[model samples]
Target: MKKEEKSKPKKMKWNALVLSFLILLIILVLPPFAGLPVAGQRALAVLAFAIMLWVTEAVTYPVSAAFIIALLTFLIGLSPPLHGAGGLIGTKTALEWSLSGFSSAAVALVAGALFLSAAMQETGLDKRIALLVLSKVGSTIKGILFGVIIVGILLALFIPSPTARVGAMIPIILGMVSAFGLQKESRLSALLILATANTATIWSIGIKTATPQNMVGLNFIEKAFPYHISWLKWFLAAAPWSLIMSIVLYFVLMLVMRPETKAISTGKDVVKNQLTELGRMSGSQIRLLIIAFGALILWATEDSLHPFDSTTIVLLVVALMLAPGVGVLTWSKVEKLIPWGTIILFAAGISLGTVLLKTNGATWLAKIFFNKFGLNSLSIFTIVAILTAFAILIHIGFASATSLASTLIPVVIAFVQGMDNPGTIHGMGIVLITQFAIGFGFILPVNAPQNMLAYGTGTFETKDFIKIGVILTVIGYALFILFSLTYWKWIELLP
Candidate 1:
């Protein structure tokens, strides 16, 4: 009884980690016992273990990735259908399969985009763009909020990172709001901060490369469906809805949190003063602007004007950003700025997803769950509505969008392919829908990094965030259905 009391506190202290660890041990036994094929069983163990670790965060993101590599190599290394031999697979072949994620072009695109996002920070180009937009939006409080949304959507295109954009813009927005004599506790301040976070989050959908999760989704889609999404192609399909969603966010905020004052006459002056202090654009800033637009033009036109893929274009852009004298940043500056840990885990996620599909693990899991939900007979629209709503709502438990995606997307693909005949469903629009819905998981600060940053500003209560975020998520859901019925149908991505 004394020993039990002592262990109770210890187990309570770890929350889900210890429990998840035990569950993992039990999960590894199920596949073989349940008569799953050897490779599929091994793959199932890896997928279950990875999802548990990701959700519990018992291990750091990169450590979870390392666990994935090590676990796969150990469990399925010698499974049947050897890669290069007549019998069991060799260590070399197993190692190659385990590490195949590093070879993905999508992985490279993410790494290069991170470097480019770092360049914006290195050159203060993001700040320049924010200031430039704020200066143009005029003195009205409404216009300033609109300008922030404009910057969010626009920056999301070239930056390819919502967190980076949030880090650069939050301080500036808060400072300007303070300069306007708006108190931090004021409804206006909370609304503006929430607006910025929601706008940035929404942009993740419209631009495929804007967040690593979107890229992860595309990678999963390519594996499951035949259609490939291009940079311009994604923009045309989802961008308009982002604009409409941001506008909806703005009005929703106004209706819910009526500001203390209707207008801030000093707001324009505040932004103009900041720009004046910045003086004329520096040489590095100018060079960065040129490169930024150069990359944008290429990204938007790559499908037609250039034969190279999006990853190749991003690689070229990063090269120009680090080119000795002409470059805006150096190796020393960018090396520390890039989040290599994120890159490691994201790369591992692609590999994990690939393993799930190749080994039939994803399909098997899909069958089990689809059977439980009776989704097999539901219409495509009904399934999508349910799936998208579930995706958005499920974000409440996740603290990282990328991790949520790495875990959810494989299951989503399986669900889509679960119908009586896979031919009965088009399978094209589901990925796009998943991309849009997943980004709207803002019911709490833990839902996404942008929300966490915005929450840190201390302008809003958790209750207020939940109240506003849930409404916006619902609105975002409706927009997804509307776009599916209209824009996506016109584009032939959906029947």
Candidate 2:
């Protein structure tokens, strides 16, 4: 009886949830009544609700995403009817719009990528690669850091999921550190893990299929505009940025946390022993290696050498990976290993962003911002910088780079359209850098999916993340602006 009384009192205590509820109510009721178009207002209302849910996380991300589909399923009548599907708004039509995100090929790519990551872990292929690279890099702290980065780049090229990449790297790298008598919380441990985390995100912009967010941005362009950015073109524009940023990332890590012990001296021996323990690759490992490399070859060459889209090629590889006799993964094994929640989150974010563009909600939001701030008189440089800042700073509210890009890429596009007297160079320069910069999330654990995964390992604290994050974020943005003026201008791509 005493315990029950105490529990009842505890449950009765006030929480801050009432505020979120009030905010949600205001969004739902007031937006539809605003001077927005019927469709725009409804889309805006849905966006507001999504923002609240994402910020509070009162529910799991997937649940909140599911809520979006549920709400759109019922309340879609408030918006203008979409064309091409009976040319009217109805529950059926709304459901289709909401479900399209869940069904997008980008989401499938992420799912397939997850299964492939599971394959590496199950077949011990990831460990073998890690050991092989670390072994060749020698015993110096700098060399080992580079080794960790090399593993990250190699895995990231094929593994689209940052969480999956980090998931694979963490165990192998941590095991290696353990082999060397390093503690998880030490500077070296932190450096190694941070290198892994940093590279996982850094490579997102380098490869077309490297991250879902990149695809999300592409989706926005297709939905909002008539132009196309091919997989090869995206890589062409971003490869240099990625290469330079990678060098910068490595330098930043070295500058921030100079290891007390300059050289491990035994790293080679540790690598030798780890490789010896791993033994020769199994048949499954060899098969997975071939499949992994094959997928890479197709993705890299598809734009020039073939007609299939990136997603189609990815799905083909996935089908091959699970084929009965030649496959690397069993359905039973992948079913358990896939990050379904993230897949759902990706779907929801894409859906919301897609609907926002469809309903003209993104355009309305931009006009509102411009009117409120009197950005009407701003130059293209100022406008692009503000948008860039928004693109980067907005990560505070979202943990997934995919979600952040989906939500803001459309906004960035709208702002680009708003610019006046923009020459080809200025407009394209601003647009490309603003969109490309969205791939990076260096601020908080919730800023990037990988950050949260790295935080889970308990190797580094929030403070550790902030210091390095600031250095990278600042330099990254600065480099972006400088490149726009120099290299990008010289190449005539911006012009």
Candidate 3:
């Protein structure tokens, strides 16, 4: 039975691998349609294969990324040049293009952000901050819920990684429950776990550095348009939505998954004990706090108080933290801890998006897809309604928001660019709006890493999660459209 159980996954993986390659072959062998340039068609084939691999978990992401680069090199290189005097683009030029993502400011920012997350982890600053906030929220259920939300928000600001923030909170929440002698499957456990995960998801919108999905969208926009959404600009435009959603999260969790008790009574004691175990703040924690706050200031005032972009600011922070005397972390200590595969996957995703633009693959796709649905004739309001629904629905199949953004943003950019400008409609604005919808991973445990983390605790049944998620999704969708038509329009973030 054990052997069979293991073999099932192996069989499934093999099936997915075959299907992905079959897709690539079928697309490649198909004659160019809709005037898709040879290079563009090849790029699409590579993209489809990568998407299948990503969605199916047929192979590890870094392995998939390596496969993508190799395919792009050969497939695109063998195709005719994109423009002017054509022979072959050649593997040399194609290889250079394939590797271009590593040089992008967006990719660099992600790498720097990972380094910062590692620093926080190594210094235990993230845990101390979370515990400190929880310790202050008192012993009531309401206060604990509020503290969970606040901790998520605070961490989103200081720690750039969504998974890392949630990671820091999960064990603490679990430990608090254990310390209080609460059942692992108790309502309070479910409520706290869900609250922690959902809070992390919600705040990913308000802060630019909170998630790599934002970076993915920003990357596509910068590659295709002159507009640059500074950290402040993004926060100003999106924070209100996140703030409103945060409130909704608290109430919805309270209503749908009300805990059995009004208060843990021992909540404060448990938190205090945990804080005591952490002991006094170390020198490393103090230095890390100073650096984190400094970075926050620089991020908020970007492009206004200084010309340094978010990427530059992040790189600087990383450099400062890694410096000999001035920094808190050593390269030798954190080197193995850093997720190098994620960096590779991020860079490869960027490269794929860029190639789609360079070869006009995205443009061709946008035309076929939107025209088939008659979306061009719809009002901007109606168009957003449809697009956001599509974005949310599509997210159900993707575990990584970064992959979702990579696959969706380029096509969205192409679609918006092809629309009637009307002076008010900008691809960047529509893309930003759609990116918000992409963050709606509320409905399923597999939808996000945080959700999966919460699910692994066994505190909530799948049915319970779905019930609450349905409500949150509906409310969130309604809020998304409302914001798009109201605040986003007033701020000129939408048409």
> Using TM-score as the measure, which candidate wins?
3
Kindly provide the TM-score of model 2 when superposed on the true structure, using C-alpha atoms: 0.90
How much is the lDDT of residue 357 in candidate 1?
70
Query: Which digits, one per residue and each the tens of the lDDT, describe model 1 over residues 429-451?
Result: 77567766787766887788788
Model 3 residue 440 CA deviation in Å: 1.3
Per-residue lDDT tens digits for candidate 2, residues 325-429, read 898788898888877887888888888877776667777787787646866577655665677777788777776677677667766667666766466445555
Greater TM-score among 1 and 2 belongs to 1
TM-scores for the candidates: 0.92, 0.90, 0.98
Model 1 scores a C-alpha lDDT of 0.79
Instruction: lDDT for model 2, please.
Output: 0.75
Give the Cα lDDT of each candidate.
0.79, 0.75, 0.87
lDDT of 3 by residue, 1-495 (tens): 999999999999999999999999999999777678899999999999998998888998899989999999999889898774659999998888898888888988988988888988888999999999999999999999999999999999977777788888888988999888888888998998898888888888788899877888898887667788898999998889889989999999899898999998899999999999999999888888998899999999998999989988998998889888889988898787688888888899988988888889999998888856898778878888888999999999988888888888899888888887734335577777888889988898988877887788788998888888888899989998888779888988776
Q: Candidates sorted by TM-score, descending order?
A: 3, 1, 2
What are the RMSDs of all candidates, in order? 3.7, 3.8, 1.3
Indicate whether candidate 2 or candidate 3 has the larger lDDT: 3
| Candidate 3: residue 490 lDDT (0-100) | 92
